[model samples]
Target: MTRFIEIRNGRVVTPSCVIEDGRVVIAGERIVRIDRAAPPSTRSETVVDADGRVVMPGLVDLHGDDIEEQFAPRSGAETDPTTALATADRMNVLHGVTTKFHALAFEESPEDGRNLENAARLARAVDRGAGALGDNRVHARCELADASADAVAALIEEVDVDLVSVMHHAPGGGQYDAESFERHYVEDRNWPAEAARSAAEERSGMDDASQGQRIDRIGELARRVGVPLASHDDKGRDDVETMAAHGAAISEYPLTLDAARRAKALGLATVMGAPNLVRGGSLWDNLSARKAIEAGVLDALCSDYHPASLLAAPFVDTGESLSTRVNRVTRNPADIAGLPDRGRIEVGARADLVIVDPSPTPTVERAFVAGSEVIRASAGSGAAPELPARSRTR
Candidate 1:
């Protein structure tokens, strides 16, 4: 029972390409052939003419935070994990993100950690056929500062954690400058003002001696579990060197140019936030994504907080064209994650693809996973496959 889908006359985008008048042949759940012009056979079951549209590989988001969005839908209202996850999945697919890594960080707060556990359970549930939504993966973004060595080791064993990022959010340092630090712990995240103040004060009280011990403990546990490690917002060359010593394979948004250079030199793939790229700069005082790309210091772009941002980043600086930007989100992240067969359009690669139209505004027309059409453009607009007004990618 072999089925075929011929994407005729579309611009095919791949990891190492942008092909005009391209054709893709899908056999069941995998891409069997991709060429400028694929000949049709009597055995072919379907043929689709894209009418000169842009077709590309689906986006791969290494770090996404839709759980936080669903949890705090409006100020204090909290959506249940199941509902939130379902919503997040639809949002991702409609926006063209085929592969997403949910950054389920363990908070020291019991309530927050419990919420993460629920989210983790939900991810496993969906992955195990609880629902047919989207490709949702759970990546445990561990807070080294809040977790003990034993707690971290236990978490790895407890959950089917995919990526274990070594994060140290020391108030007033790295990503959070003093003012922003106060906002995260004291105001925005709903931490009790007084408690947040006290915790920040206590952390500041620690000398390099105690801080080093804590860092080492978490690093040791992460290494023991053999999870991929990432250094968060490395500050300078010294910080990059320290991360390299710990066998960090990715540099997640180094804050300084020197740190970015050092990370690249040490062989760590540099990842920047897609939101930053579309917004034209970092939310915090960090490296500009466009500048990083121009300098060749960036390797991959993650959705970070907004899944749709992955689709928009490639279009922001149109000089590179849509295919090139699409690769930044797909092939780059897959390669960094060590997944070779899923990010590109080639023989034997998984048939994960997105059909988009770069018309008045770039938008995803339809999406497929394992050769199954998972989402199609909303018919209400009649705008020829444009992103719905209320649909969110970020």
Candidate 2:
């Protein structure tokens, strides 16, 4: 039997919105019909009065590093990965993120043990959290030329890896010149002189011939896995062109306007950090996400390192309305990722919806996933669920 959930008396917001008294009919986790009136033949099973609230489809987050934040709430500080992941998952779901892509990258590991352990732990936690009553998915952004490709392939084959990318952060090329790399290492990462010197000493051995061979091998692996590949921090048109030729369809955080322009021209979806849009510019002093959105080069906005930014982004506008800003993070990312089934309130789409009440300031009132309420106002009434127990491990 097809179950029906009738959401009536709300403004259904989408790419095009309808501010009217209406009913959204959900039949077996999919919206079967949306009409201004209830059908005469069948009585609605569940009726949720929206009270004139704005009812919209749940947001889709293509890329988010907030797991890193929850794991390491402070720099050089570590906590239980599972606990952190669970907390982050609840926070995101409550904030209206129905589909979240948590990119777990293993970088700067001199030994393979720590990287492997972290990846396994993250994969387990994501699986648990997603299976729980939350919105989360692990998108593994594996560095192709950084780690042994065999180790990475094993990870892909073993774990629930969704999205993979070919990233080459080696110095003196791809995204950073030698000078920029030095600045990023010494200044940004706060690496000591000896550590930075040791890392650079190894990269100094990679010649163009060897780099080309490595790139080709990585590209071949991506094709073999049949996973969507992305290029990170594209610096120029040539870099975009090279990656596109290698079958990468997404360019993440293009550092220069020229790079972004070339990516759009090449029919690549450009993803920018929402923190960059919220903060007004890039932390690395590169091209601003807001600027790219305003210029019409940016297609999607990811949470990057902050989960709350995804909720806060809908209220932001780059000289456009709030609805427009919301679309960039919602419908835009979904379309770019080729996920047309979700991200909208149209009939036949998933019945994931979020209701926001901005009486005083913007706040998420309630959130639902296919007629299941995940968050309610009772949490604010001091009946909040207990925080999960933390387990200790390295």
Query: What TM-score would candidate 1 get against the native?
Result: 0.88
RMSD for all candidates, in order, please. Answer: 4.2, 4.5
lDDT per residue for candidate 1 within 124-155, as digits (tens), equals 54344234445666666666556544554665
In Å, residue 224's CA in model 1 sits off its true spot by 4.8
Overall lDDT per candidate, in order of appearance: 0.73, 0.70
Top lDDT model: 1
What value of lDDT does candidate 2 attain over all alpha carbons?
0.70
What's model 2's TM-score? 0.84
Q: Tens-digit lDDT track for model 2 on 121-143?
A: 77668756633445566666655
